[model samples]
Target: MTTARRKPYGVKGAPYAFLLPATVLFSSFFALPIGYAVWLSFHKVHVFGLGLGKGARSEVWAGVENYTDALTDSELLDGALRVLGYGCIVVPVMLGLALLFALMLDAEKVRLAPFTRLAIFLPYAVPGVVAALLWGFLYLPDVSPFSFVLEKLGLPQPDLLDGGPLYLALSNIAVWGGTGFNMIVIYTSLRAVPAEVYEAAKLDGATPLQIALRIKIPMVASSLVLTFFFSIIATLQVFNEPTTLKPLTNSVSTTWSPLMKVYRDAFGTGDIHQAAAEAVIIALATLVLSFGFLRAANRRDKQEAAG
Candidate 1:
């Protein structure tokens, strides 16, 4: 104790000093907005007689009334159902294509691997709104080359922007834009697997498909899970594609997605309190579903390990 030396003040405070900017930025941008939203969720406007004067309206505490209304709202529920249906198509198809492309890229004797990977991934760099707009044009019967070809061939040209096909159209845009990123993630994971493992598999007379199924896939299971997790969250929060396509299609309503509904409630109807409440609900639902999936995945992993 007598021989102990004191640390310099700068060294002792260095970690906090380094973190100060991030802490300030997080508090200012993220934390403050979230706190304000939560605060707004629990408050509503109270209007006096005629609702005309400057002092006529005031903010008042609203308990759980906003949350109750949001839960009971048919529009919100329908939007949730629509998003769920969209997710069902998007998640599996996107992940499947990603895995397929990643495996193909990782295979031996593959030609132009870098070019192929870049071609597949380039769509992801495009903004979602631009992607939607581009696809929206393709979906239009008059402007679409597919429709023109079908007409020339004397075949039926299906309406892609309306009814059942609308879901497929939206799902395609998501899959196209998302597959590349997931493929890269999975491919990176694959590249990290030991070469000796592949050599041993080859020595055991395993074919390429067998090796991929047994060794490669199992080794990349965590990557798959991670992609799946992100896919689920993105699916639930879908807004841009639908919103961008909305102008071109009569089928996409103002309340097409939960987020769209939130936007409509906040700006369209000028009800920030209601919008905040709905936003909070959507955030809570996303959190619950994400964590629930993670928990199930963890439990399965633990069981597999024990087995």
Candidate 2:
């Protein structure tokens, strides 16, 4: 027999209906938090005389006071500069190693490729906090393998957890923890290059380096751009690594990085308003930098295509 007739717009309703749950979840977790942070950014607490009663401590509208304070705060500025330096080291080194490893994997007669790939990617499975903890301990002179070898050879053991080396020390953790994931991304795209393309390049008497530099790299440019975009964001949002390392090192202040400073302000100092302003600033910076990178990459791709 008989079947019920569907509504005319039911076809359209079906997709949105399926997406409703995800939309709700995204709103709840991401959108609401952002909105609330923004709302809190424009308010502050009021303290009357005596400051000892519930009525004495009241919430009041701050009127951009928090934003002004955040912008002028030397600690926040220092944290931002520190993070910039850290990101400068992390982004290039991680992406470079990723591209290098990916190209190596794409090479002929590569040994232990499957095993090497799995090994390299294994760290990606580790949580960033856990990875930082593991690497933090390894940076300790008494516990580090490098320091152990140096000690055996009667050489001076340098402190990795402090001073100028602190940048590289923090950077190494980010690089090690991130390289594997970026490598796999670049390698997967590298593998997707057409076999015919390589054959054509070979027919033209191009060496492997030429094929990679000219063909594979060009073909994989989109993937490189995507990876670099994500890597830059990750470098900017570097909180877990530096925060985890703080317990073991003194150089890392309560405001070591911008995100860490936000965390400290919001939770540590119980000032969500100032933190919110800083958070919004960071989010904007991320969007600007990421969009700029994508445009630059696209321009290069177009140039390559035209040439």
Candidate 3:
């Protein structure tokens, strides 16, 4: 009986025991915060007319009031649209640059690959705020080499801090900061592709372009999917870049992204309940979008595998 009872606690269970600390931390930090956020999202405070005494305020069930408010908020919706526009530029440009750098690095005759790779990726080590600050300085007319050059050539100086140009400025920061990581992801996957695959394509009289497009890219689809997923999530949570840029420009508001709006609402405006509700909605939307993209990617992968 003792031996039989002890079987469950053998090597198999030992790993779980080792993981107990991590599980506890997850429950305490991640799980609890998420649960509390959801709970708080559904409640609001009601204050009496006098609004004087402590007991004058009471928590009341708000049901979907906050959710509806968040959804209907023009500021948040505009922020969402702004982020979407920024993402349109950031996602493609960043990933394209990443893919280009990866391909260049993977090439047999590329020069300075190591130096370029490190230089490009070094921005990732810099905090987002610091990166924004650094880039912000570089964008300033007094400090920018580009502006100096344009001035020398007597060309019209473009305003980068306002209107549509601001999107480009913000997108550039994200692209510069993110490209190296995505490049590494793509490059690692590229490295993992067997030499035999390339040799086989070569033997088949396939040109390098044909080999890259037909075989190399298709093989690294999984990595691309992963990068795309993470990039989209990061795009949705864009906060630091705009916030940092705010000191230098008046275009950026307190609510520059949906997440930023939620933050502003919760802390800035003292509306945690509304912020919580907005947060839940954003989380749900993100999950739905992510899962949908993942499912589509999986389907495409299966089809490619079958073919």
Candidate 4:
């Protein structure tokens, strides 16, 4: 007790050693790329002498000019609107189907539960591009079995790749791919409820529907919130499906979504600075919307608990 005790070397350094790999990877992949994007967002290419050669073009500080232009860009705004509409359809339908399937799987009398779950979840295993291509072929009038059946039945074949139906077409792909994952999350949550809780509900004369609505749903609220959070983020970042379907239809433009516009700006037009600015804006929007939703959910939970 007279002298301060020294910690063992291994114990003292163990935490840091454990964290080193994660820190390095995060710095290399996430931190560096984000930092570079922020830096690029604040700069632009200054061209001189007819802008002909590499030496004539140089990087210069742009301040908020890039941001200003991005915020006002009509294409970006339109893309954002399109994505918002797409999200409206995808979020509700996907989550609803997921919840429905999870509840069904949790039912006592459900048959072939494992096979049914696997069948629903299998689409998520397919790559987004492949899923889109598969759906794209099915949407085509010349190749689709659905279209052929409709033609034989004398029903008008709706154009799924253009106009209003295009939204449904894209939303279906997202729902098909996403619903299974969300279902599994909710189903796991459902499984975690203590058996005694269900017994107590049954003793209180609660029917299966009542037990599900009052007990199971409330207990699994946290999982629902989590799935909703992820669904929102995914909806905001929709790119792969639309991009994959672009070659099959004229309705999907290069700027069909915000991320698509970023791709077009950065690579299509070789305007990296503007692209970076737009990318930052999208990131900020995503963060703001995501956090705002989380805050609202937390507040509602607090209110419900108080009641």
Best by lDDT: 1
Candidate 3, residues 42-89, lDDT tens digits: the string is: 999999988787799899999988889889999999999999999999
Cα error, residue 281 of model 1, in Å, equals: 0.6
TM-score-sorted candidate list, best first: 1, 4, 3, 2
Candidate 3 displacement at residue 269 in angstroms: 1.0
Tens digit of per-residue lDDT, candidate 1, span 48-137: 999998999999999999999999999999999999999999999999999999999999999999999999999999999999999999
Per-candidate clash tally? 0, 0, 0, 0
- Candidates 2 and 4 compared: the better one by lDDT is 4
On a 0 to 1 TM-score scale, where does candidate 1 land against the true structure? 0.97
- Each prediction's TM-score against the native? 0.97, 0.93, 0.93, 0.96
lDDT of 4 by residue, 92-184 (tens): 999999998999899898999999999999999999999999999999999999999999999999999999999999999999999999999
Q: In angstroms, give how far residue 105 of model 2 lies from its true place.
A: 0.9
The reply for model 1, stretches above 4 Å from the true place, is 1-9
**Colliding residue pairs in candidate 3:** none
| Number of the top-ranking candidate, with TM-score as the measure | 1
Model 1 root mean square deviation, Cα atoms: 1.8
Task: Provide the overall lDDT of each model, using Cα atoms, as 2-decimal numbers.
Answer: 0.97, 0.89, 0.90, 0.95
lDDT of 2 at 180: 95
lDDT of 2 by residue, 1-307 (tens): 9999877867878989999999999999999998998888888888899889669988789988888898899998898899889988988999999998999999999999999999888888899889889988889997899899999999999998999899998999888888999999999998888799999999999999998899988788788889889988988888898899999999999898899899998899887778888998889889999999898888987887899
For candidate 3, which ten residues in a row score worst on lDDT? 1-10
Task: By lDDT, rank the candidates, best first.
Answer: 1, 4, 3, 2
Q: Which ten residues in a row have the lowest lDDT in candidate 4?
A: 1-10
